[model samples]
Target: MLGLHKKWCLGICVVVYGQLLINALLTTNKTWNELDWLDILGEGGTALLILLWLYFILAARPGGRVTNLMGAGLLAFFVGVFQDALDEIFHMGASTPWHSVVESVASPLGMILMTVGLYFWRQEQGVVNRQLKKREKLFRQHQLVDTVTQITELNYFKYHLRIALSAKHVKRKFTLLLLDINQFNRVNQRFGNAEGDRILHAISELIMLNLRDDDLLSRYAGDRYAILLANTIEAEANVIGQELIAAIEHFAFKTLQGERVRLAASVGLACAREDSVDSILMRAKQALALAKQQTNSSALGQLVAV
Candidate 1:
């Protein structure tokens, strides 16, 4: 594309150069000094436009071949415009030896700058093409899996509830598990927000890795996560909950001061009933509250029937 643009610029320069030559030789009725103000404005305005385009391309699309080429082309085109604009305002007569030399230099200089910019633009396009190819592959893989819909919170609950009820006909049940990191606010208060964010990301990844492919995970709230286990019974859900507790218990996170901080999580599991999604979530939350009250510590897990 940059090559095409450069070629178009070169063509315009050739046409403009021919017009200047013809006007110098045959147009005896108009003197150079008699040039209209509009003529000067037109030429100067074009030069300014070319310069602005060059500036934007350089500033916005750095490290790209098309941008570099367009930048160079604009640079060359501006040179011609500069000379033409000056010719309108100043009567640099054809008889002056330097006048012809100056006018002749603009076209060639513009062409050279444009050519160099196009070369870089082509190199940048190659890199972009590779990135696009990788993106295409990722898109194809995503099509094969059942992905969650990005919707409002209310809609998400409604949709998941419908799915759960439909699955019950096939003897498939769902379990909801909520995990809250203990004293997470203290970490933010003591270490920093950056450390807290890192810890959250690490724990989320661990939970994701341990879950079945059909399980859904979401950031429930600050320091808390909700997991939706598909086709899971209460007994199986308890086993999974135990594994998650053990995994988090064994994880050794380092503080900003390089001290190892032991972290624990409180888990609440609830089996889904024929009721709404809201009811299931509320029961799980109540169970979590009970666990926290009974144990008086973060490292607690409970399973409550809804």
Candidate 2:
């Protein structure tokens, strides 16, 4: 995460330095009597709060579109608040057009940008929440989260699948993709379960990276994973399943001893119908059985679409 956000730190430094330069150039000497105490308190407080916000945002979030938006917005906010604070300390003559522009224009523009950024941030969170729903039986509890993959387990996946099945606006056309690593047991036997656990964790991260942010991924038990793709058709699900299979097949995970271990995955794709989540899962399981059968005959497993 530090490596991901190193550039943002540089950008923030630039903004801060630029603001300091502006303050040095434009600010005037004002006596304590000339400064309005109430305005100083208000503007200084606001600026401090914005600075804290900027620090938190950069420190907390990874570098991405949403992070960029919020960072730019926070920068704008700091600039606005800093300018406002300067208005309290500096005695800028009415003839100066620049100070007036900073005083009048910066705050609202910053607010507008921040509002826009927040809107996009909420949209991003919606996608995250959709994915989180699959891994959580109840939204608020953190105990149910899988410690290894940082996803949910089978019980949580089932609980939410049922809710999705019963939603009024349900498409009745969702898909579930189940992926099981071929020869996962051999990795444990060869390297040990600790190494195997690391491999599973790596594989789960790879699968999540390939999937849409709204798609749900969970550890179904042991080496199997289940994904819930809402509003997806069988054809699309097949494409996704195939992509997952290909991705896992291509992934070269390194063992602690510096040996590379390539893995192949069997994938099952099954579309939901006007039936219960249990029935849908059973169909996916059946598809997985076919995929495993095919894997036994070939070096790499193919996606079995049902």
C-alpha RMSD values across all candidates? 11.4, 7.3
Find the number of clashing residue pairs for candidate 2: 0
TM-score of each: 0.49, 0.57
- Superposed on all Cα atoms, model 2 deviates from the true structure by an RMSD in Å of 7.3
- Clash number for model 1? 7
Model 1 clashing residue pairs (backbone): 65-120, 65-121, 66-121, 68-117, 69-117, 69-118, 76-110
The sequence of per-residue lDDT tens digits that candidate 1 reaches over residues 241-287 is 87887788788988778977677777888887775777787888987
Candidate 2 yields a Cα-based lDDT of 0.82
lDDT of each: 0.66, 0.82
Backbone clashes for every candidate come to 7, 0
